[model samples]
Target: MTVGGDGGPSSPEAGPDLDAVRYLLVGYSADLLVDLDGFLPERSVAVVETPDVIEARGVRGQIGAVRCLAAVLAAPIQDEANAVRLVGLVPRPPRIGAVVPASDYGVVAAATLAAAWGLPGAGPDAAPVFRDKAELRRTAGGAGIAQPEWRLVTGPAEVAAFRAGGDGTCVLKPTNRQASVGVQILPPDADVFTAWALTAGAEEQMFRPGDAGGSRYLAERLLRGPEVSAEVLVRDGRTVFFNTTAKDVQPGRHPVETGHVVSGPVTEEVAAALATGMRALVEATKFGSGVLHGEWIVVDGVPHLVECAARLPGDYIVELIAMAYDWSLLHGFLAVLEGRAADPAPPVARGAAIRYLSAAPGTVDAVDGVEQARAVPGVCDVLVRVAPGDTVEPVTSSWKRPGHVIATAPDAPSAARAAEQARAALTIATHPGAGR
Candidate 1:
């Protein structure tokens, strides 16, 4: 894993800095990977493992305590088993008690693992209400929140009915998935059978079968409007609303979140609607504490709750918010874990945004304009993950992304424009990789 200092290198202290409590950032090292130049210097910390490796790397002592519980890093079954094994090896759970999973899959897996070990964690039962699209819609509906008309279909019969007599158009999506993978827009008089069949197959690949549940998919009526997400942090059974962000969904689809502009210039009315919808979610999910990532669509004047996750927003959304707001949410999570109160200081900066450098599906042969993109003013920095010889796949989900450029500016629009300019300057060429 990579590490950096915020200001200057810390003076080599006597032994490892074990005075402060330690945190185990589970998941791909990417989440904690960024802005460490700014995040470090505050204290001394250590990382468990790298993203490429599946097994956990043992870290002796760097902080006050030790524990392994990162959701994103534990996605593959092997990683999950390793995380559990690490916890078991510790003799006891870390004194600094809390597990803040930043990914949807992480939250559920972390919760399940923590609970299995009798630690205070969000379990599958509490997690599904937010992680599963079908479950979120159903839970919101039961809580009297307005949801897009939805149907849980298995085979031909259910798909036929939803296609025959539902709204004008319906969106078919996998139940246990995120970032709009295997999502299809259903058309009227559509080849309902064929489309449904394709959607089902996508779900199987999207989720590890026999691991969670079975054959569960959502046929949801497509809602139209400006999209927004309320990224709120819950603490001690109370709601601590963070900055709201504007989302750009895949052009004709609803679930596919292509990119996001933090703190969009939205109307007061829209803000109120977003806040109201989020409040409803906080209640519906019974989310006493932790992150509540909720998305909404403002239709005509009514704001419908699209879906929610009991975790932090991905693609460094929380990082941008932390930078803009001058708060360390990752640290706040730790504080909450230590039963400390949060300081309510709003964001000081005006804008922060991330534009993903997406590419067409193919094996990557070359990438160009990196130097030019880096030279753009207001373009903070570019960290390209895919190399010249790496294969690049279609932008189906957040995982298939080429890389992302995070930019900050005086306002949202300027930041967005700079990001787009940076994106436009780059190009990627793909060819068949060695194996596949």
Candidate 2:
């Protein structure tokens, strides 16, 4: 599958020299803060984060390692307006080179600040295009792109109208949230009150104020087919394909992604269609320079855009691509951003998969088989997130996962099998009614 643009020359004027440019990573996740060292040049990157996230997210140890740090109004998504303003408040803010949003929430802030500085990034114009689902549909739909039938709903009456005459199985979710936080597949008998309740209180606002959860939602017709994600890098309107991920999400009220397989089982035809749709999407949004994590579904040999983010994909997909390609997507992204020579083509066609470990809802008493899982053939790492005395709840979203295992093999099947074996090897003990 090829995702090529008009074959224009590299935009040498995209940004300043890599060494001369200072990167502003806008968010606070311990993993993201630490990993920036690999994608970015050390001593050239700074951060703007909320004070509480710095403490609650367990990034305290990273404070000394960062090049520089500043506090904003609140969490990245919680107070986006103030977060953008905080950039100018930082010392030597004018010297900032490029703005890199660490997550979806910081996208708007990155765009806002980047526009003010005239730096290389997704500008303020494209923020709403990617941040709001309704905007995505409007732009992509106007560009003659195919997508699932969706109805924008602000309350129960709209939900009722969409459900009364439509199929019972549909995906309804918040217009602004991610990680499947408020997404639910309503049962046929479910009513508008259920929809409101599902979308309203499902968010962890993190001290947000004033429409932080958003006032709109969408009810999308469920399309059944294999779902895949394409990571695209856009520079000066010239787009190129990065990689594809095969996703597996359970069909339920709260569908959580079970695992992912990189460069997994996708037909050549479908791949080509996905690449084309992704290029169209990038063009539609006017995303000049940035990495897009776009999801799509293949129906009857045609690719329909599902959703996308103006940032990189999370859940170790970057690491998985690195393992398969023997290259860092970050560096490739940097090359694209700076208009330098870079190739995202996979050097070796290998498969990589990651599986999460979870158990029945209860209070964690004992965990077993971490080492055993790690010892599995082709398994790379096993990370456990819970310990004894930590209460566990029924997983409703990807954030609730306790641990995960990553593995690689010659093919997707073998990789998936290895990942499953590794996760199956682990054992977590818990007691019922112990979770709060």
User: Top lDDT: which candidate number?
Assistant: 2
Error of 1 at 211 (Å): 4.6
- Report every candidate's CA lDDT: 0.61, 0.71
RMSD of each: 7.1, 8.1
lDDT digits (tens) for residues 38-137 of candidate 2: 5455446555455555445544344345533322223343455454554454333445556777677778877676666766677677876787888898
Deviation (Å) of 322 in candidate 2? 0.7
Q: What does the lDDT read for residue 301 in candidate 1?
A: 69
Clashing pairs in 2: none
Could you tell me the TM-score of candidate 1? 0.76
Q: What digit string (tens of lDDT, one per residue) describes model 1 on residues 282-314?
A: 676666556677878878867788778777677
TM-score of each: 0.76, 0.86
Model 2 bad stretches (over 4 Å) = 1-21, 38-42, 50-61, 65-95, 205-213, 338-346
